[model samples]
Target chain A: MEQNLQTNEEIEMQLWEYIDGSCPINDMQRISILIERNTLWKQKYDELSALHTSFSTNVELEQPSMRFTANVMDAVAATHVAPATKKYINKSIIRGIAAVFFVMLTAIFGYALFSVHPTTGTTSMLPKLDTSKFNLSHVINSETIMIIVAINIVIGLVFLDSILRRKKEQQAVKP
Target chain B: MELDDTAVIQMVLQGQQAAYATLVTRYQQYVFTLVMRYVNNREQAEELAQDVFVKAYRYLADFKGNSKFSTWLYTIVNSTCLSHLRKRKDETILLEEEKMVSISDSNQAERPSDKMEQRTQKQMLENALKHLPESEAQALTLFYQGEQSVEEIGVIMGMTTSNVKVKLFRARQKMKDILQSRFSRELNL
Candidate 1:
């Protein structure tokens, strides 16, 4: 009997379903009976209902800033920049391949002109044939070719150096 | 009229990229309104709301329609606002500290007392909202201001209907307590 009463008077029964108009007819009757029989419950219901109405009606909802809509639209535009923007990797790889092609052309030009000269060095490319009196050393020492390869090595070193420097910088800046 | 939120969202997912503008126009007000409640600052709320909508557009494909469109949108807005609050520097206030100061002096100075009272009420309400736990505040505000039902609030909050009502009840009770405390002196009845 006590458990049944406790279950019937659960928190949900206090007022929410009644206020929400969600209580079924049977539950509503039970609540009505509770309200009629219990002064405290009736008073609490009146107070909560009034408070809900007061707060809901009296509170002024601040409209979002005037620029809100514009800003969101701008953001949407920015995200879809080209709608179907091409894949970045394809563009980057194409650029990389072009760079390699240019370097290879320069390497071949140097090999033909300087490696065949009757002077300086050995060709890294042709390790087998040595009959021509070409100065492979000239090509080997070819300042332009050396400069290009040296630049590539320097770039690689610079990139690695920057990465290490960045790591050290991050460590130094940590609290 | 702009495309409906669901339509634009669907179009954007289908790679009809321009459809995003329609969605933005359709729901920016609603999103901003939720964000404003959370952040309580116009500029910051707008910025945060914008960021949330942009994120939603990016992830529109993942939005399964388990809830109404507006409810789902607000869920995203609420999450963004909560994150914004987390990143803020203000100390949280308890719900018990709400005070209703008289705006009569301000009205006598220039404006009408009604306007001043309205402004005062707005400030008091905002303060009261800030004091509640984030979920309780969100649930109540969405329920009252957005006119959302228990089931709808439940969907937006990702809670059961009973849970949403519990939070709403607690939130309302807290707000009432605060209001009563603040106005007890001025109000006779």
Candidate 2:
């Protein structure tokens, strides 16, 4: 009788866990004792079990709408708009052109430094005395470097003008 | 051919943006229903569901494959629901009180008829669930959803397995009393 009472109390305490099939093995054995000993409790448990089963099987499933997928895709597209193609082209193409110009200017300076020599001091006798200020060593060493730098400055100004013009055109065209 | 969740996640991490759409399509309904259980409003549920997907996309890189993808997704859903509840502090209490009052009023004025009794019972159960403590309501719903093991639920809710068992017991009793009383009261038994 005492054992039966203990089983009944255990069953009441762990009834939901038993119904869920989540009761541990030891608890299961104990609850099974109560089930066998008391037919009323077993009947009540079975009815409740069936009720839960009925609820699960009969629960309504909700589908958003036929347009749900399309709506989501539309929202995604609307949010992350693709920037204009001309903007991309202006960015990469202009930067590439500028980079090429700078590299070419550097190469010209290098050639002047290593490959060209200054005219001899035989020309120093002329009245064009700019040559008086320039020695062959200094002229040969510095002329190419200075000319290459000047070319780079001019190229930089030209590149800046083109970039500004392109940006202005883009802004102007956007109505 | 269909790829598994792990494969889809890997593809997404490799910068395959389209793979994300597949993940969303597969789990959107499940995620939406889970959100609906919390917010209980269809439109708000939809918005929260979309927000959850966007968040999952953003944090897909951090999903380390330690758990199933669904578990990770559920963690995100649970957090999103909790955050929403926190933001609208009185909204939950108001919904519960509304449900309780409606149930009480319907009980007093209306005769218990046979034809719509099942519908009334279901409504009563839902109302009772709305009136449950937030933790108990969530625990019971997650249990019935059948997506996770008791251990997994305990992990999700940061409760002990025994504590989850006890809470579920209370929730079921509450449901049982509500359902039984609805029938008995209607028939004047």
Candidate 3:
């Protein structure tokens, strides 16, 4: 009885594939023979066939209001026009700038290393550093503080702008 | 001959913005139906469908013509609907409510007996469709109404062709099961 039930389920699945027109041709022929010879198979096939026909005929497509296209067009008109030219960020330009910066940094380091002639008497090529002389008060002047504050404010504004733009893009992408 | 979507896109890019209206009108019904599957609210679905078109227009310049225009538009529709579904995670519309509303609407219209029967059958099928899992419903709808082949449905749904076939098969079986039980209950009553 268990074996028969398993076989029936397999046959039912195959019959569905056949109904959907997704079965292989050989399998389709096999199911056709089964349907023709077996009353149970024939009954199931008939019922499924009727249901499939109803699905094809009865499921109606929902229509939007008459103003749907017009509303979409108006929304498009209010937005920025898509550029005809490529608007994507050019990676090549960015890579080129990065390459130049790297090369310049390497060249500067190479120069500093080559200029450090240990053999040239007692004058060290490295700059003398005195931590005690470097006072935080000197660096914390009004003008310098203002400059640092201005830079932070500019960076913060740019960061906030990018976050807002990304949120808008996300919203636009959602239905 | 009418211009193809590619040609229409080119025209739109070349400063003929009105050319886009043709595409919009051509696809509005299809977009609305697809979005309705997710939202289940006609007004919200219509709004989402319009949003799809507006986004499509805004991003038209990015289209590279690698795929069919309809495929590309359907991709946008799918993602948009999925994101909206994610946002309204707890707010799915009940299938029973949809059935009641549809039946009430049909009652308001003076239909012939045959037409009423047809409407009831259609409603039953729709309710059956709603009972399936979302992926199954989406797969069946895309296969039947979107007129997409299994391969195309796979591309749109981000699944393999075989997976799409399985989903379609399972969806149909589940719909059949639902209809059988529902009809049997009605008969008993």
Candidate 2, residues A97-117, lDDT tens digits: the string is: 999999999987776555533
Q: On residues B60-109, what C-alpha lDDT tens digit does candidate 3 reach at each position?
A: 88777756788778889999988888787777644545654654454445
Clashes of each: 5, 0, 0
- Tens digits of per-residue lDDT for model 3 on A1-175? 9999887777777887899787789999989999999999998888778777777777887789988878988898887556634556777888999999999999987777777767853325557567598798877999998999999999999999867755643343332
- The DockQ of each candidate is 0.15, 0.04, 0.23
- Candidate 1: TM-score of chain A is 0.36
Clashing pairs in model 2?
A: none
TM-scores for every predicted model: 0.56, 0.61, 0.66
Task: DockQ winner between 1 and 3, please give it.
Answer: 3
- The residue-level lDDT of candidate 1 at A103 comes to 99
Give lDDT tens digits, candidate 1, residues A1-175: 9986665346435576787787798888887887888886687677767766766786566566666666676667677532323433478888999999999999888776666536655554555566686767756667878799989999999999867755653343232
Worst 10 residues of 3 chain B by lDDT: B180-189
Q: Tens digits of per-residue lDDT for model 1 on B29-140?
A: 6676677656656787777878887877766765666456677678788777766667663675223233122222222344222332444555666655765665777787
- Model 2 DockQ (Cα-based): 0.04
CAPRI quality of model 2: incorrect
The worst-scoring run of ten residues by lDDT in candidate 2 chain A lies at: A120-129
Query: lDDT tens digits, residues B1-189, model 2?
Result: 999999998887776767777877888877776777687788888888887877777677677665668767877888898899889977554555666576567556554454336655446456556656666676766666636665555656666566777787766665665556555553222
